[model samples]
Target chain A: MSLAPDEVRNIAHLARLAIGDEDVPAHADNLSRILELVDQMQQVDTKGVEPMAHPLEGGQRLRPDEVIEEDQREAFQKLAPQTEVGLYLVPKVIE
Target chain B: MFEHTVAELSRLLADGEVTSEALTREYLDRIERLDSRFNSFVTVTGEPALEAARAADAERRAGRAGPLTGIPMAHKDIFCTRGVRTACGSKMLDSFVSPYDAGVVERLQSAGMVMLGKLNMDEFAMGSSNETSFYGPVANPWDEKAIPGGSSGGSAAALAARLTPAATGTDTGGSIRQPAAMCGVTGIKPTYGRVSRWGMVAFASSLDQGGPMARTAEDCAILLGAMAGFDERDSTSVQREVPDYTVGLGQSLEGLRIGLPREYFAEGLDDAVARVIDEAVAEYKRLGAEIKEISLPNTHLAVPAYYVVAPAEASSNLSRFDGVRYGHRCEDPQDLEDLYKRSRGEGFGDEVKRRIMIGTYALSAGYFDAYYLKAQQIRRLIADDFARAFEEVDVIMGPTAPNVAFDRGEKKDDPVAMYLSDIYTLSVNLAGLPGMSVPAGFKGDRPVGLQIIGNYFDEGRLLNVAHQFQQATDWHTRAPENIA
Candidate 1:
C-alpha cells in the first residue's frame, strides 16, 4: 500500500511536477502514511454504495448553448505569463 | 471603532453619528498600526477604502444607503477582486491581477460594503495551519507563538485582533470554522450551493464554500445575507431564494432539539476543549434546549475520505495553472513539459505538492477504483449518517476543533497530525451541511468555540442559535488582552 520512491516519481511525472531528489524521500514517506490512512476504507462494507461526487444530491443544471455574452479575450489574456496579439504563448510543443 | 460589530457601525452611520470616512480612517489607522504584530492582512487597500467610504457618505447624504453601506470588510485572498492581486497565498499567482470581481465581492460591493483589503490564506486553501502561504504564516493574536487555525487564518485572526470588523472567508474541509474556533470569532459556511462560487478560486469544488466571518453571529448574519444567493455563473448555484439571515436572530430556543453526537465527544477530543463545549451546552440547556445523544458512525472516515476527494478535485482544478495562461511561468524552459513541471514545482509549496502527487496517484491507472471510488462511497456513508441524525434532532453540536490553537511549527513538520486539526469540522463539508463556530469560552488565554451543525439550508437557524448564545455570553467580545 506504500508508494516507493520510483512509484512516487512516476506519480509526480503524471502530475507534471518536478520533485527534487532531496525532497522525494520525505514525499514518499508522507504519501505512504496517507495511503495507509486511505487503506482504512477496506474495512467498510460499501457494497453497492453510490459514489457521491458532490454534496448536493441533485444533477448539475445545464444552460442552453448560445452566445450570451461579449468576448473578453484581451482582458482575460492580460494575466497570462506570455501572450501575443490576444493569444496565450507557451513553450513550443512541436519541434 | 475596531471593537464595534458591523451592525453597530451600520446603525451609527445611519444615525449620522459617525461619518463613513471617519470610520474607515479609524479602522485603516488601526490596521496600519497593529497589523505588523498580527500579520493578518496580506494587502491593505487604504486609498480605495477611503474612496469607497466617501462614496458611501455621499450615498447616505443622497438617501441611498443600505445596511452594509460604508462598512469596511476584509476579504480572504481566494476571491477575485478586480484590479487587485488575488494570490490565494501561492507564488503561482503572485503576479496575477484579477480582471473581474468574485460573485461575493460584487454583491457585497453593491450592498455598499467597502473592502479593507485581501487577507492571507493557506496557499490555494490547501493547508490547515496557514503555514503554507507564500506570504508567511499569520500569527494568532491571542498568543504570537500559537498558530491560527486555517486556511482562513487571516480572516479569523484579523477578527480576533479587531483589525477588521467584518471579513469574508471560505471553508473547504474546516477552513472557515476551525480558524473561527481557534481565534474566538463567529463564522458560518452555508450549504454548498447557497453562495455563488463563480469567481472564488476553486479548491475541491464540491467541498469549497465561501461564507462570512466576524466578531458576532449577528455580524455574520448581516454579511451572509448579502453573500448568499443563486448566480447564473456558478453551475452548482442552487435555485432557491436567499433568506434574510438577520430576521431569525430573536427566535426562541424553547423546545429546540439539540443532538450531541456520541462519536464527536469520544476519544481524541482535548479535555479542556470538551469542558468548554460542555459549559456552552449547559447554557443552551438553560436557554431551554433539549439535548439528546446521537452518533454519526462514519465520522471516523471523514478525514481520510476528504483527503482523497479534495486532493483529487484540486489536482484537476489546478491543472489550469500550467505556465501557458495565467500565473507563474518557469524561466528559460527548454521544452513544454519542463515548463509545466518546473513552474508547478517551484510555484506550489510542500503540502500542496504532496496532495497533488497523492491525488494524481489515487486517480492514476490501476488505482482509481481502490482510492477515488472508495472514498466517494465513504462520502455517501458520511452524508447518510448526518441525514439519519437530522431526522431525529433539529441541530447537532460539537467542538469545532479537537483542541484549541497549537503553537506555530509544533505540528508543521508532522502532516498527519496537522491534518487532524479539522477532524471535528470536516464531516459538515462532506455532507454539504451548514455549520458554524461561535465563541463559547476560554481554555486559559486561548478561545474555544462551540460548533453548531444544521441540515442543508439551515443557515438561518444556525445563526439564530448562535445569536441566542452570544446574547447570554460575552465570549465573542473577548479580544486578545495580551496584544494591547
Candidate 2:
C-alpha cells in the first residue's frame, strides 16, 4: 500500500493539487497509512452484500422532473474565472 | 439576559416585553463581546439583522408574525445566503458572496427569523472537529482549551454560549449531533431529503442534511418547522408535505420502545459517557418507555465505510473548485495546469486536501471496485442493520461521542482517532434516518449527550423524546459561566 514518490506526484496531478517537495514525503506517508487502513476492508467477508448507492430506499426518492426555472447559463457563467461565448475556458487538451 | 431560549424569546417578542430591535442588538452585542475567544462566527451580519429586526417590529405593529419572527439565529457558513458572504470555512470560497439564498435560509428568512451571522465550520463539511476550519478552531464554550465537536461546532458553541437562540446546521455524518453533544445543546438531523440542500455547498450529497441546533428540543422543533421542506430545485428533495414539528412535543413516551444497540454500548465507549447515557435511558424507562436490547451488528464498519464512501463522493463534488471558477485562484501561473493545481492547493486546508486525496485514490481506475464499490456494499449492510433493529424498536439510543470534548491538540496529529470520534453518529447518516442529541448529564465538568435516533421521517417522534428528557432535567438550560 506504500505510494512511491512518483505515484504520489501523479495523484497530486490528477487531484489538481500542488505539493511541495518536502510536503510530498509526509503526504505520501500519511496516504500510505490511510490506504493501509482502507485495505483492511478487503479482509472482511462481503460476498453477498448489495451495494448501497443511496442511503434512503424507494429508488433515489427523486423529485418530479419538471422545469422550475428558465435557463440562466449566461448569468451563471459571469462568475466563472474564464469564459468565452457562453463556454468555460480550460487548458487546451487538443492541439 | 442572554439565556432566553427561542420559545421564551418568542413569548417576550409576542407580548411586547422585548422589541425585535432590542433582542437582535442584545445577541449581537453578546457575540461581539465573546466571539473573539470562541471564533464562533465567520461573518456577522449586523446591518441586515438590524434591518430585519426593524421589519419584524413593523410586522408586529401590523398584527402579523409568528413565534420565530424577529428572533435572531445563526447559520452554518455552508448555507448560501443572498448578498452574504457564505464561505464554507474554506479559502476556496473566501470571497464568494452567494447571489441566491439556500432553500433553508430563504424559508427561515420568510419565517421572519433575524440572521445573527454565519458560524464557522469544517471546510466543505469534512471533519469531526472544527480544527479544520480556515477561520480557526471554535473553542468549546465550557472550556476554552477544549475543542468543539464539528463541522457544526460554531453553531453549537454559539448557541451554548447564548450568542444565538438557534442556528441552522447541515449534518453529513456527525456534524450536527456531535457538536450539540459536545457543546451541551439540543439539535436534530431530520430525515434525509426533509430539508433541501439546493444552495447548500455540497459535501457528500446523499448524507448532507440541514437541520436545526438550539438550546432545547422545543426550540429545535420550531426551527425545524422553518427549515424542513420539499424543494423542486434539489433532485433528491422529498415530496412529502411538511408537518408542524412542535405538534407532538408533549406526547407521552408510554409504550415507546427505546432500543439500546449492543454494538454502540460495547468496548471503546468511555465509562463516564456510558454512565451518562445509561442515566438518560433510565429516565426514559421511568417515564414509561420500554427499553429493549437491540443489535446493529454491522456498527463496527460504520467508520471504515464512511471514510471511503464520503471521501469518494467528496472527490467528485469538490472537482468544481478549479481555478476557472468562482472561489480562490492563484495570483499567477506558468500554465493552466499550474493554475488549477496552485489555486486548489493554496485554497483548501490540509484535512480537505487529505480527504480529496483519499477520495481520488479510492475512485481511481484500478482501485474503484476494491475500495469504492466495496465500501458501498458495506454501507448497505450498515443500513440494513439499522432497518432490522428499528423494526423491533421505535428508537435507538446511545452515547453521541466516545468521550466529552478533548483538548484542542489532543487528536490533531492522529486523523484516525479524530475520525473514530464519530463512530456512534455516522451510522444514522448512512441510514438516512432522523437523529438527535440531547443534553443527558455531565462527565466531570463537561456535559455529555445521549443520542436518540428514529426511523426515516420520524423527526417528530425524535424531538418528542428529546423534549421529554429536557422536561425532566434542567441540563439543557445551563450555560458555561465564563465564556471568554
Please give the DockQ score of every candidate, comma-separated: 0.85, 0.57
Cα error, candidate 1, residue A7 (Å): 0.6
* Model 1 Cα lDDT, one tens digit per residue, B364-462: 989899999999999999999999999999999999998999999998888889888889899899899999999998888888989999999999999
TM-score of each: 0.99, 0.96
The reply for model 2, stretches above 4 Å from the true place, is A58-78, A82-95
Model 1 score (lDDT): 0.92
Evaluate model 1 with DockQ and give the value.
Answer: 0.85
TM-score of chain A of each: 0.89, 0.70
Per-residue CA lDDT of candidate 1, range A12-72, in tens? 9999998899998999899999888878888898999999998887777888999998998
Give the CA lDDT, 0 to 100, for residue A44 in model 1. Answer: 92
Encode model 2's per-residue lDDT on A1-95: one tens digit a residue.
Answer: 89999988888888999988889888888788777767777878899888898866665445477877788786567667778988877767567
- Segments of candidate 1 deviating more than 4 angstroms: B482-484
Expressed as tens digits, the lDDT of each residue in B135-221 for candidate 2 is 989999999998889999999999888899889998999899999999999999999999999999999998999999999999989
What is the fnat of candidate 2? 0.63
The i-RMS of every model, in angstroms, reads 0.9, 2.2
